[model samples]
Target chain A: MIQNVTLVGAGNVAWHLGAALEDAGLVVDVVYSRNYSNAKALAERLYDAVPTDSLDFSESKSELFILMVSDNVVQQVAEEMTLPSSGAIVVHTSGAVPLEALANAGLYVGVFYPLQTFSKGKKVDFSKISICIDSKSERILDMLAEMAYKLSKKVYHLNSEERRKLHVAAVFACNFTNHMMTIAQEVMESNGMHFEMLEPLVRETVDKAFAIGPDKSQTGPAIRGDSKTIGKHLEELDGKARYQEIYKLVSESIAGIEKE
Target chain B: MIQNVTLVGAGNVAWHLGAALEDAGLVVDVVYSRNYSNAKALAERLYDAVPTDSLDFSESKSELFILMVSDNVVQQVAEEMTLPSSGAIVVHTSGAVPLEALANAGLYVGVFYPLQTFSKGKKVDFSKISICIDSKSERILDMLAEMAYKLSKKVYHLNSEERRKLHVAAVFACNFTNHMMTIAQEVMESNGMHFEMLEPLVRETVDKAFAIGPDKSQTGPAIRGDSKTIGKHLEELDGKARYQEIYKLVSESIAGIEKE
Candidate 1:
């Protein structure tokens, strides 16, 4: 029933999702962006899609409008927009934000969060990414579910509270883990080793998580109660106070797990 | 040249590495273990391989003997065994042990640290795992390099000091990251939510690391300096003092990265 869809941002998520929706035989009405070049770039990749400015959508011809803007600006963008009516489904692709922001504007609101990281140049396979959906109305929810299921194999109807909880887990699992990798890369790069050398280990760590639960799959000197190695590493860390502190904290945590 | 390789441990690393070597056309000669069943279990997987408690190996029998025992016993095992000759390669699959332990035995000594977390009941793919090799002699080093390359796509010829440094990074990247995951799972599980729900987020976190360098790829309320969300997560964590401390410490680290 999703006849026409309008995209209101031109960032990484928008670029990927627009292509996916179009590829699935959905009619993409118009794609808008404050940055004309970004919008045009995404629009050029989609069939029968036109790059347009905000003024072009004044008529609100589409049945659904997806605002793939930054999380901080989602509310502001919703407030600044004029919509067709209170019936059209409006959704934002932010993992953290609730659908209430769109509801306050008297428009049918929902969330269409694709649970994966997006990089501008990287090709994302939507089939593998999980999609989290939420909406105020059951009808809109059904529509969103259909659209989401077409793109991803896994779709969850997470309430705002549950979605927020998932978002927090996401921060720990995805964002913080990546920061740890960054620290590893920095440590190696400072010693004249390429960051690419860590890629195999990084991939293997993730692969292990999928195979065995993280708790049982955990391994290192910290778990083995080998303080000799831990002390040596702390000394090697030297002046990097943050890295040393992290090593201490994580080692202590690993030691606790072993104790339990 | 690694026609017959002897594995001197029956743990997970030894089990997986021995299997990989056999699969790669290298004949695994003998699997020696203190626990007879563990050795037999691993040896059963390889053709023409036998498990034994035999500590004595006649000189010039096997070309390479992989000491995959626990770190604490590696030195003892090296001292107790009779290696082939100075030309025979003696390698221990430990990240922390010094190569001189085997060198003191009047044979070629090296380290074959497979940079991965191995767990029983789960199969591993050696094609992607990184093997860090260290040796005192060039001939032994070349042979180890050839074997490592045959088993894995990535093999690094690092000295003992550099291998030790990389091991420290592995602790941060793999073991520490897995602990963080356990924390995330604990937080959700205690709140009457299933840990399975966090799987999508966990997968995305690792996939994101592969896409961009972890530092630049990181995104969260902490990185964005949104104290409101961080405070909310702390409140949600409640009486879990350790998780709260970790959440705070990691958030501060993310914020510090932004400041840098």
Candidate 2:
């Protein structure tokens, strides 16, 4: 059983995860960041956590170390960290980085990736989030699973490759979908239409996608092969080159899928 | 006041709209479809509705005619329909087609576009749907708005150009977003991952998009300009040429937006 955790970043993920861990009665010993003020701000919220900008974990005694840093610095931070040679499990809260990224940091290494978008000041209901975990050993896996279950109702034992694949899928589902919305908002704004008008349509679209499978739920001029409507829409987007390219490509893709 | 409605299609939209009109205590005198059985099915559910596959309205007495057909056939259907040449108002339930498409058919022409996706078996609450109405004159617009208000709480008086622009925006917000969900589901299914795992993430993504504006809520390696992670994801999509192109283009677009 992991009683205490050392949080290794103070960004969005860490801010939420640290709070969740504390809520689950887990002790957070230290909150570290490259910037001391960030670490201090997060550390003050915990029950008993020291804030520091140091890589030296010599004074910090914790069973679990969660490196919630950016993907690029995860390896560098893991390499620079000093932890006990035994009995300490080092994990990174990254969807992209594999467990091997933290292999050299501790005796037991794993991933404790929470699959949800985190934003500062926005409260995340951890119970709704899926926590994907992987470890090098069965014992470590079970330990991480137990820890994860405290924070989330959905827990999965996903290996590096499976988690990475899930991450890429997430980018399409969340990131790309959000970008499409951005473009939609831009289209509405450019035409002097209020963005709120699209809300009902947006909600219904997603509800339909989930109700019927997206492939079957697909509806539009592209799927219907209404060239006239598609042509008019293209003309509507006359000078917006980037949007035009996207519209043409995505419509072609939808048509291709419909044919299949 | 328009008390009687002649519904000129028996598809998803017509099915929902017919029921809503009847619920509002407006009489639905007829339900027409190219297929007799479809018309019969919908007509059976309404009070005193005549199911016919004919364009002849000489036998039918109704104050309003709603041509809820496909966009491509909307104009064609309107041209073929025979309605009262003076008092009866004509409208098409389409976001794309302009009012002119129905002008020559009836003395008073307009649009009664319910901006929400409808499925035959699924019940739609009209109150939540935004009904976009437009007409050639204020009197006609007011008439359409009154009828629309009986069904939906949200109603807008959009001109042809504004409605067309809204329709294009809907394509991005609804159709394109659905396509993104399709791609994400495909990726998950291809990797032996159950698509249900994405449901929470999908719901949260949309919630976040609405909570904060889509542009501000954008989160991903692409928006962060993390090329290393982007390159890694591209490597993961290796042989899927279409998906790779989409990932590249969308990521580039996101990066470009982030820079601004």
Worst 10 residues of 1 chain A by lDDT: A52-61
Error (Å) of candidate 2 at residue B85 is 5.0
Clashes (backbone N, CA, C under 3 Å), per candidate, total 1, 0
Q: List iRMS (one decimal) for every candidate.
A: 2.0, 1.1
* 10 residues in a row with least lDDT, candidate 2 chain A: A81-90
List, residue by residue over A97-182, the lDDT tens digit for candidate 1.
87786766545789999887776666777887778899878998999999998998788888887777777777777777877787
Candidate 1 ranges with C-alpha deviation above 4 Å:
A30-58, B48-50, B58-60, B84-87, B187-208
Clash-forming residue pairs, model 2: none
DockQ of 2: 0.79
Predicted complexes: DockQ each: 0.57, 0.79
lDDT of each: 0.80, 0.89
Best by TM-score: 2
Worst 10 residues of 1 chain B by lDDT: B186-195
Q: Among the candidates, what TM-score does chain A have in each?
A: 0.92, 0.96
Residues A22-48 of candidate 2 have per-residue lDDT tens digits of 999899999999999999999999889
